[model samples]
Target: MTTSVIAATALDPRTMAAKGAIELRQVRKTYGDVVAVDGLDLSIKPGEFVTLLGPSGSGKTTTMMMVAGFEDHTSGSVLIDGRPVDSLPPRERNLGVVFQNYALFPHMSARENVEFALRMRKVPKAESRERAEAALDRVGLAGLGGRRPRQLSGGQQQRVALARALVFNPAALLLDEPMAALDKRLREHMQEEIKTLQKSLGISVLFVTHDQDEAMAMSDRIVVMKDGRIMQSGPPEEVYNYPLTDWVASFLGDTNLIPATVLERDGNLAVVDLGSLGVGRVRDRGAQGEKYAVSIRPEHLKFRTAPVAENGGTGELTSSTNLGATIRHRLSVGGHDLQLRELSSDAEAPGRRAAGPVHVGWDADKAQLLVLEG
Candidate 1:
């Protein structure tokens, strides 16, 4: 983990209170007749890590641009703390922005690159050097200050960019897919480092990414976007396990969606018939629609010798794949292809993969009935 000295210099309550809050009220953006972002209302609390996640052209990037003052909104207002910042330029927004490409000047050394921000702000040369070197040290690049962007590793270069953004002590950090170029292992490493730094500094972060796992791993809250609109926003587990729409269920992660019919309702719980999967009770959000489906994540599915008392059925195992920590099994149940994942350490996992009848089951609470918007 990357440690920082910012804890000693943590911003005061008044400064955090003023710079920590980022809010967009009915913010909309358009290009002639085409809408890029439609009525996005979001809030990033002080010290909170909020991610805007979606596919390409989902307006997640556009929304971040607007917040950073790079793009102008056609309607609604953008506020920092409680004051409007719609008229502020990107530089004037007091936000530390790290772009997808770690935009560093190749001509300058890491120390020089980090000092450029303080230089632009007219800090004295001595003060700029002191603060720049300190910032580099804070990001675990203390001795590499003399290296140019080309001389540093991808991770080191990212540190320089972060140091530059932090040297000025901006209130909030705006990260736009900052880890997109790194390899999978490196990207995951940087995710941990960035989250650690954010918590250490106690700064608000408005992060944008299309990678669902990335959002789940780093964000305090996930704001899912779809076609310029927000589909769902909540804690990672809540949004992933209890998505309101089938689109969200599939987008967040792999899920086995089973067609279901609401047989009865009791308050927030509903007893539903799963046809071949058997009868089960699931959460009822009182969604109004005739199209209903139960979403069960592959990891939550279980295998047993007999059908579960509630939601279980006998199925033919088609194939099984050893996926490192877990084994993935595909089965054909009632003409529908369903998959279940079991930890590799499970005693019964290997037996289920053997050539025999496969009995599949899911707990009642694990099945989530959702409205199919499509």
Candidate 2:
């Protein structure tokens, strides 16, 4: 492989002690006629924990492997600290990679496994042992260093693999579904640990995962990908609360989508007619059109036991489910289906007494209007 170094600007003082920033420009990977990544552009600031999240067959994992030098890109560039390294070998790139499965050697003890990298790099025997012990201790396996991989539990083995990754102190750490194997409870605990470790060490982390909640909980920023392309990239709150498109809105969480149109605009609010619900006013900002989809979260709807005439809208209880603190009910409103989640102690389902029709209404500001995409 051939590599050429280009001059890069000096690092900022705040980011001087941490790993370098990474940049990918128009990066594409193709196998025969199939394209895994299509003109992907991403920038990761120094010491940032960025997650690449998407469904199966999205290009998240492929992009990460290219950064680790494990897979070659069909075109474009991969730069570290502003220096292009598309042609460099994996070892020369100074990257630490953690796979989903624990890739520890069966014959080597935990301490020996962590020490192997240092030994291969020609560190003195005494120095190797000291570094290995320190790494094991850092991962909470100080006393279990003598045990082999088979003797340790799955979580313990993962910790050993983590220790091994940190032993060499690479410039950046690449994790591919690192928490996929562990049970739900243990996975939560490890997520916190991993975030804390990344912050403390100030290492640049590129994490890939298919789990939406896990990505939202652990990452500082998320890059949502679909069909071999990036759909959106931003802070977790921004991506969750202010989605750029309707596809993003529906994928992130449970929402009640209602068909509506813009009635009129005044100041920052626009009044909308919610069909059979009522001629209720809604906030549409400035959009006015014939067809639109209004999105409201299920938890935002308010249900009441009053008559349909007394309440603002008409609703009929179609189904009910008990979810501990709240009772979830699916109400059919004319042609649309709305989900109402209410505190059980606050109000019971309106159908118990044979009430012919119940009612529910939502605040105008709680609605989001999604226009037809081009």
True-structure RMSD, every candidate: 2.2, 7.1
TM-score for candidate 1: 0.94
Model 2: how far is 215 from its true place, Å?
Answer: 1.1
Q: For residues 245-330, what per-residue lDDT tens digits would candidate 1 score against the true structure?
A: 99999999999888899899998888888887678888788887978998889988888777566777776888788898988888
Q: Give the alpha carbon lDDT tens digit for every residue of 30-56 in model 2.
A: 999999999999999888889999888
Error of 1 at 38 (Å): 0.4
Off by over 4 Å in 1: 1-18, 347-352
TM per candidate comes to 0.94, 0.84
Stretches of candidate 2 above 4 Å error? 1-17, 263-291, 304-312, 324-327, 342-356, 372-374
